[model samples]
Target: MAERVAGILLAAGSGSRLGQPKALVELGGETLAQRGVALLQDGGADPVILVTGAVPVTIPEALAVHNPDWSTGMGSSLATGLHALAETDAEAAVVALADQPLVGAEAVRRLIAAYAGGASVAVAAYDGKPRNPVLIARGHWPAVIELATGDTGARAFLRARPGLVTQVECGDTGSPDDVDTAEDLARVRGVATVRSEEKS
Candidate 1:
């Protein structure tokens, strides 16, 4: 039987450092939120959920859930997303961050494939370090939400259960760098430009 996996996009952050909503930030002509949804869909995540806060964003392709406690931190957004997922038929979820526009579908697909291969927890690793776009089986959602607090998200929970995690090396598939500052955004834009030039 095929496992039903969903995509949970955390885009509720206020982006205080960038002085704007990161979800609205544009990369290669697409908003960060839009890019996130596309990546998840293209990567094979069915029924993508976008947890929004800080600022309102409407993406036709995603089921946007507003996190009223978003100001609290990434944990709140993650909790909100997980809570929303509980009502669905998803057996697992691939969590992605909106700021990480550089994380492509290939990385997400790898995580999903890992989860499909009996891995309870799957994470993308770049240069031996685990990064965003983690896959969490439904059985671990409760523990993950319990440990998810402040900006920690699922790090604490994943750390506590390192033995269950399967790391998918995706260094060549995508970059985990997030756009948290103006300089970072510029760098992403530069990369986008280079990519566009190559495609042209």
Candidate 2:
């Protein structure tokens, strides 16, 4: 049986940099949070969690629950999502970011596959540096809960224990283009447009 995987879309950032809720930003006919949810669902995750805060807003149907404590920091939201994931039949959890509206569905799938293949934590590594859209196996959930903080997800935990971390090099630039500032959003839109044209 394929182990069930949970996906946590960390969309609770205050968006101080962009001066707006990043999750609500529109991209390719959908909101950033919506895109994150879609990517997780397409990646085979069940009970995807949308961690929210700042200005509370409506979430998509696929999103399991929202964390109100998002103001406290990313750790609070991570803990909230982890607690909810513990209730579901998920064998592992993937922590994604709503600001990263361009993380491809295939990249998420690769992370999950690597996690299922016995990796404690499989993260998308782009340009020789690992980034979010991280998949955490059940064995590493504790660490995720421990190090998740202030818009910084599980990276600290992974870095603190390098031996247990698995880097899944996905040839994707979208993973690094997280929309934090107005300029970032514009850049991502340009990139998305270019990619869309290529596909056509």
> Which has the greatest TM-score?
1
Q: Write the per-residue lDDT of candidate 1 for residues 65-170, one digit (tens) a residue.
A: 9999999899989989999999999999999999999887999899988987889899999988999889999999999999999999999999999999899999
Clashes of each: 0, 0
* Predictions in order: lDDT: 0.93, 0.81
Candidate 1 lDDT trough over 10 residues, lowest sum = 190-199
Residue-wise lDDT of candidate 2 within 1-200, one digit each (tens)? 88888888878777888998888888878888888888888888787888777866565556546677778777788888888788778899888888887788888888888977888688898877888788888767876787877756676787788888788887654555778799999999998888899999
Name the lDDT value of residue 114 in candidate 2.
92
TM-score of each: 0.98, 0.92
Model 2 stretches with alpha carbons more than 4 Å out = none
RMSD of each: 0.8, 1.7
